[model samples]
Target: MKVGIADTTFARYDMASDAIDELKKRVSVDIARYTVPGIKDLPVASKKLIEEEDVDIVMAFGMPGPEDIDKRCADQASNGIINAQLMTNTHIVEVFVHEDEAEEKNLPEVAEGRARSHARNVIKLIKSPKKLIKDAGKGKREGYPDLGSIRR
Candidate 1:
C-alpha cells in the first residue's frame, strides 16, 4: 500500500513521519510525507498529494479542534480523497512533554498505543467487508439487494 501522511503542525508532522516509518517497518508499504504550511493548507495539500502519488490511503495528522478537523477531512473526502485524521485528547499532553521525559516515561509507547487506537478507529470509519455484508442483509429487507450504495 502507498500511504501519505500529512500535517500542518510541525510536531504532528514529525510524529506522523515517525509513525509512518514505524508502520512501514511492520508492513510492506510505501509512505510519503508532507507538511502543510497551515491549517488552511490541509485540503489543498491533501488533494495534490493524493492525485500526484495516487495514494491508496492518506493519514492526516493535526491538533485542530474536532469540528474544524472534521470539516477538513470531509473536504478531502468530497474531493475523492480517502483520508483519516489522527485526533486524540492526549495531543496536548504529548506536545508539552520534552523528548527526554517522553522517552524516560515511555511516552513513545503511549503515542504508539494512541496511534494504533487511531488506526483502528480509522479502519472502523472506513467500514470493513464484514460491515458491508451486514449492511447488505439489512438493505435486502429495505428492497435493495446490492447494498452497494455505500461509497468509500
Candidate 2:
C-alpha cells in the first residue's frame, strides 16, 4: 500500500515527518510526500496526491493558529479533504494540531504524540479498518488524556 503525506510549511512540519517515521515501524508502505505553504493549501495538495500520484491514502497534517479564523480555515481544509475522498473513493486522514490543544508548555509534546498516533491510525485504517470502526464516534485528539464517555 501507498501512503501520501500532505504537510504544511510551518513550525510543525517535523510532526508530519515524525508521523511518517512512526508509520514505517508498523507497516511497509510506499510514501509520496508534498509540502504546501500552509494549512489552507493542504486539501489541494492531498487531492493531487490521490488524483495524480495514485496513492491509496493521504495523511494531511497542519497546525492551525490560535485564532477563530485559523480554526475556520482548518475546517475548510478538512471539508475539502472529505469531499475529495468522496469524489475519488479514497481516504484522506486529517491530522491537525491547533495551537490551543494543550497548554503552551505541553504543546510540543502533545503535537508530536498526536501526529505519531494518527500515523499509526492511518496504517490501521488501510490494513484493517474494522478494528477501528467501533471508535468512529469516539472523537478525541490523539495525544490527550481520554475524556471518558459523555452522557446526554
State every prediction's TM-score relative to the real structure. 0.47, 0.89
Cα displacement (Å) at residue 115, model 2: 1.0
Per residue, candidate 2 scores C-alpha lDDT tens digits across 1-53 of 89989998864536888888898888898999999888878888999999899
What TM-score does candidate 2 get on C-alpha atoms? 0.89
Report lDDT per candidate.
0.46, 0.85
> What is the C-alpha lDDT profile of model 1 across 19-81, one tens digit per residue?
565565556667666786544455555555566776655665543323556556435433322
- Alpha-carbon shift of residue 31 in model 2 (angstroms): 0.7
How many collisions per candidate?
0, 0
Candidate 1 versus the native: TM-score?
0.47
